[model samples]
Target: MGTWDSLHKQHVDVFIRINLLEKALLGLLQNRATGDMKGAASLQKDFLKAFEQGMILHFAVEEEALFPVLARAGEKPRILISELLAEHKSIMEKHNMIVQTAAVDKDKILLELIRELADHAKKEEQSIPSIISQLTPEQLNNIDQDAKRLGYRL
Candidate 1:
């Protein structure tokens, strides 16, 4: 099978992660803090922990497996990948801050991170298919193989 065919599963995994994060964000937004600061903080902490774990794996699969191949394809793909990498960096920094900051600061940063991540995912979903369509089956296979080696799972 070609790389895009294999990549569908990985994309599904990423979409799932994004959906979960979005759901978590929705929950946090719906939650009313009736002076239960500890409870609010607890929810934020749980969201952060889950987001960090999933994003680490998500970014790894893209950065290590997919980006390099796309970058080499041409200037457009390279530029796009560069932007995505920058977003990844920013997301990580925000994620780290959320973990370390006080409860008062956590919610703002967490919301920002999730919004940024959702935008990033949208860009990937919109752009990557066209870029990958230009690649050879061998190139696609390489990305698929690399992702598998890095423990990408559906």
Candidate 2:
């Protein structure tokens, strides 16, 4: 594949994984919210695994690799990148809370985390295409390799 096509594929892969995780989290939230803890633990386990395996990597790629590209794009993009980073911090905090707490009704916090992550993903979807287009072929390859090192399938 050509450079732009390859870059777009890798970038889109991250979004696809994020969307899957969000869907799983939302299902878990619905089950937990209903007080139906039957398979909730299993769902929780899977969701947690996905978060550990996927979401963290996505965050690192965006912050470490992609955000710098956006930052150089100018003031408005830099500001948006800053906002997205701040959202990641908050979402991570909630994720930590969800992982550490065994208390009942923690699905509430999981729901909150899902909402925060979904919003973050939407903001990224809006800005990432522009950022990707601005990157050089070498830069995109570096990003793809970095993301792979972080355990991204793409």
Evaluate all candidate structures by whole-model CA lDDT and list the values in order: 0.75, 0.69
Candidate 1 local Cα displacement, residue 141, angstroms: 0.9
Candidate 1 has its poorest 10 consecutive residues by lDDT at 1-10
For candidate 2, lDDT tens digit of each residue in 1-154? 3333443554465456555555555667555436545455566666668778767866786777667766887788889888988999999999988778786767778767766776676677677677778777787777667666765565
Candidate 2: global Cα-lDDT?
0.69
Measured against the true structure, the TM-scores of the candidates, in listed sequence, are: 0.74, 0.72
Candidate 1, residues 1-154, lDDT tens digits: the string is: 5444445554565556556555555556667445655655565566666666656877888899989999998998999999999999999999878767676756667778877877887788889999988988788778888888888663
C-alpha lDDT (0 to 100) for residue 94 of candidate 2: 91
Task: Please report how far candidate 1 places residue 19 from its true position, in Å.
Answer: 7.4
